[model samples]
Target: MEYRKIFYNVSEKDMSFEDVIDRLKTFITADPRSEYVLSVGTDSHVHAKDTKFITAIHLHRKGKGAWGCLQNTFINRQINSIHEKISIETSLSQEVAYHFTSDYLVELSELLIPFSDEGADLTFEIHLDIGRKGVTKDLIQEMTGRVLAMGVEAKIKPDSYTAFGYANRYTR
Candidate 1:
């Protein structure tokens, strides 16, 4: 199946990884003086006998406008536990962040350093859907630790819009 990656105003459906890198470069340069924060997150919903998962990559231009891409998949397994569901969601987001750093870091760093040198901090983040006020509270430490171990920062509920906001939209 084709990877249906959607941006805020466009769809990057079927685009290659290299193409995504290029488009991201264009997005960053579009706001020359804006600080940037790149994030990866995933949200899942169990429907019928399957689970729908949506993973998103976002580029936030601080106080300016932002855009990102998303990829979704459907799993046939019937996951009954909340722990399993949230753990899988965190893993998906971490996978994307891992790829962003390992597969495209050289290219992304080249594109982002100029802005960083100009006083714009170009940081990367992994968004977890767990929050302190819910059943997911217990998993925060483990999930955040996994993300931090991968060398990227992690944000949880209330602060992780990429997971609950953007990725959630397509989980249905």
Candidate 2:
């Protein structure tokens, strides 16, 4: 079970779910004055027989530097439908986002409230690959709606770097 949840961090060794949360806590505490955004997104690449999906969880400290990790999932067969791909991507992101439940987010936010004077803040988001452009335009409503129902902020297209950039990088 632990093996399945291991997330690969480029700047450091691989980490478990617990390790990632602990690291984020340390990062936020080290400088409570910085703004933080914890975002999750997923992107995929299709192969001849299968597709490789990469979901990234990014902890960004506003103008400052940040930390992140990736989890990869592979489907046994190619997914030709745009809807299918988008749905799967959102599902993967949901899996990661759900880990940060309401209670967990409150705990994390409590850490920053004390340093609010130093501009300390946090935003949680789920970035979707589908946008209002190209072939994905039709999916904008459904996909974003799915994320919104989770009670976390939802971002798309130009604003969704976690899926468009971070996870996309490794999917290829």
Best by TM-score: 2
Question: What is the per-residue lDDT of model 2 for residues 64-135, given as tens digits with 9 covering 90 to 100?
Answer: 898899998999999989999999999999988988864367777777855446577889999999788899
Could you estimate the TM-score for every candidate?
A: 0.87, 0.92
Error of model 2, residue 84, in angstroms: 0.1
Q: Per-residue lDDT for 106-139 in model 1, tens only?
A: 5655664453456555778898898999799999
lDDT of 2 at 87: 97
lDDT (Cα atoms) of all candidates against the true structure: 0.79, 0.87
Q: lDDT, candidate 2, residue 91?
A: 95
Which parts of model 2 have CA positions greater than 4 angstroms off?
1-4, 113-118
Error of 1 at 31 (Å): 2.2
Alpha carbon lDDT of residue 110, candidate 2? 76
Highest-scoring model, lDDT: 2
User: What's the lDDT of the predicted structure labeled candidate 2?
Assistant: 0.87
TM-score of 2: 0.92
